[model samples]
Target chain A: MAADKVFKNRIRRKLIQIAAFGFTNCHAGNFITGKLYNGKFKEFCTPGLNCYSCPAATVSCPIGSLLAVTGRADLKVSFYVWGFLLAIGAVLGRAVCGFLCPFGLIQDLLGAIPVHKFRLPKILTYVKYAVLALMVIIIPTVLILATGRTAPLYCKYICPAGMLEGAIPLLLTHESLRDSASVLFWVKLAILLAVIAGSVFVRRFFCKIGCPLGAIYGLLNKVSLYHLTVDRDKCIDCGKCAGCCPMDVDPVKAPRSAECIRCGACKAVCPKGAITIGFGSGRKAAKREGLVDMNVYSRK
Target chain B: MNKRKVIGIVILIAGIALIAAGVFRGELDVILRKAAVVCMECIGLG
Candidate 1:
């Protein structure tokens, strides 16, 4: 990828992120009036983690909606949200995180603040899986079975996106709501602040450590329709792609690694142009490039 | 298509079917009701 191409990609990504944020949050009037959009559009979910409670949001966060609907003792799990998420993940994988998530955009902007950014420790990167297993899955299931009740614990306790997108806007506009702020709000605010600070120092701290949604999408990265391929026959074992990867993925080594966000940074930096990303079925892109997909899934 | 491609298509079909079933079950209303209102839990309240 040449410098101009990289610049173009970056610009394109930023514009898309901004456009997505606007598209998802287009009910701007709701923000001024401090009211949520109760339109039929709320039935669907944005692919990224935009909060349904956000006044401007036209759709729901699938993770939040899943936990809320599933946690209820009376209702069966709403397969709609799950299916929507699954369909998106199957096609796009973590590309949703890279391109569509409003929260990801916030983190990316924070990461651009002329400051040193550290790659998350590999051990810490696995925390999101544990979070998904525990908070999103096991705990909710256990609570429902034991007490006949469950809650969206992740959104309530740990999701900084919910806090920033849903809570802050509501609180700012509604004095009565602000007056009712509790210890829980303070605690969540503290967590949100910590997450923001962490993002400043470490890229995608929340996505790498706390986002169950990211974990779920990452699981499908290998099989997703849109993905990256590294042409093995292009030669050169250069480590540039790995060095530039925001998610700490070594595209040459693990092109389909669960940690990859498919942001195209690696592809943008690949000197040999061995990387190809976007929508394609199976290894068709690899075959077209006259290269083996480097058997990336086998090694690391 | 290869196995991976087949698998992807299958999963996609399954997903769409599940969504349609959910809609038929009126789960769309459930999501709309939950999402249309201000959620207290999301705001760190009851």
Candidate 2:
């Protein structure tokens, strides 16, 4: 199958933009290294829903921070966490996974390499919901009650993001951390390795089948302020939108499907220009041909 | 191969290895203690 020309280039442009941001912000003085994104000058955290814990993180991980504040017995006002999640979700939704998440970006680059892809069974997809319910919420609450201390348990134990963005960097930068590898660290490392390797065989099997955050953000595909709209009038029912969906959404029946990540692949591939992205009152529906000159690059 | 099945098997094996590591040290309780913390802390369910 030929790769979609416009999607490929759009993806590359997004990656380059992220890489350039990373490059410009690599300076520790500018990046704000530590728990507070405020101790000195404020720097842009990767603008995704990643956790803020995991020691090597220069910018705060939002989900981790959110859970931390939420799980806290203290009940302090988590203004940063609330504001950050709201602002990002309101503006971009899960487009963060497609365009901005450093870890998601890494997985996509790995997937872009030629490999035998696997079609995961649908039953496994529920695992992410279980993770969200059990790990993210229930477990943390239980632990806090038991120990009177809270931690981002999922990020600490299960997130490959912690391994990539936290553990590896800390290990590389600190010799003491190398000697301090507990069995738990090895377990997380092994999982990280599997996730990285698995991306080659499964298109975001982690995000599709195991990511609690994806499960949460994906729901916004329908009602999020920014969203995808499908024109039933223009849709030829070719199933191209569903075919193009990386998260396996049936764009025909539920164009705002929970699994839709708003990656806009459906928009790029719609033969009849049936799908579109819209915001606020300017959301007048249009046929595909209406957006003929609307280059995909500029929209993002 | 199912990733969860693979993870389950790995966890089982690791649990066994940890038991052995404890038995050799003549401190079975230590293994349980270590694993208990991890199980509670790592599984995200505490």
Candidate 3:
């Protein structure tokens, strides 16, 4: 039974990685020939933070699309982009962070490297929302409204994903791009290096602390159809769920916390089989009962 | 269903409708044009 479980986990990881790469690889530009695929699929937005500027990217980043439309001189609201994000968030919440985002996949791999892992302070989790509000939304809107110039402030100044997936590949391939690289490029490179290093010691550092997309999705976790539910009756309160969580979410206490990526790591590690992922009001029912209905005694 | 589930369904329906309308209206052309170019600003070159 244990061997079967281990095999299933390995398969799950492989499938998730494949899906992550598949979304990014639809265009599949030729790296050797320095040709990026310019296909029709670029019209749509990918669910995760795959850089549109990346040679292999078939779709635009949703966050980038949001900023692009918001910062346009025309300044029309991107209902399509907003709607797309909302629908996905409502459906899956931050599951995309765990299973779809190429950058998240990279961070997960980096976290596998032998190192002393540590949990970040809970306060730091709120930083992504500030980034979402200030960098991704407010700043770009202000810049466009003030100067009538389109400025993707987050993509330009932050977004180490863009630097890693887009700039690095293009710069290495195209000499002109390399020659034109400036202080901003170097700054982005530094940030990218820091994020990469941080991920090794702190699993999903960017997703936990800085990803505006994650923040947007996190907001919908409470209402999302797919979410984690803890069966308090079965839980031993041994803290196994917390111990197994890579994102430092206490699934037993707050199964629907915004920080949770719905990665199912806790579900896999639960000795008491207390955690489950599903669609419904199971979590709300649990919450209403004040965590395991103490009124009823367990037969165990 | 709960209020949250009802609201989620409404939002999902509305979102799908908006996206479909946008597609029919040729807003995707705008997205395509923006995406066709290598966004220098996105890569921090500009």
Model 3 compared with the native: what TM-score?
0.91
Stretches off by above 4 angstroms in model 3 are: A1-7, A281-300
DockQ of each two-chain model: 0.76, 0.02, 0.67
Which 10 successive residues of model 2 chain A have the least lDDT summed? A34-43
Q: Which lDDT values do the candidates have, in the order given? A: 0.83, 0.57, 0.80
Q: Give the per-residue lDDT of model 2 (tens digit) for A101-151.
A: 666766777877897777778788788889888877787777777776766
Docking class of 1: medium
Model 1 C-alpha lDDT per residue in residues B1-46, reported as the tens digit of each score: 5566677677788889889988888877778888999988865655
In terms of DockQ, which candidate is strongest?
A: 1
- Candidate 1: residue B42 Cα off by (Å): 2.1
Q: CA RMSD for every model?
A: 3.1, 13.9, 4.2
Q: Rank the candidates by TM-score, best first.
A: 1, 3, 2
Report how far residue B12 has shifted in candidate 2, in Å. 44
DockQ-best of 1 and 2: 1
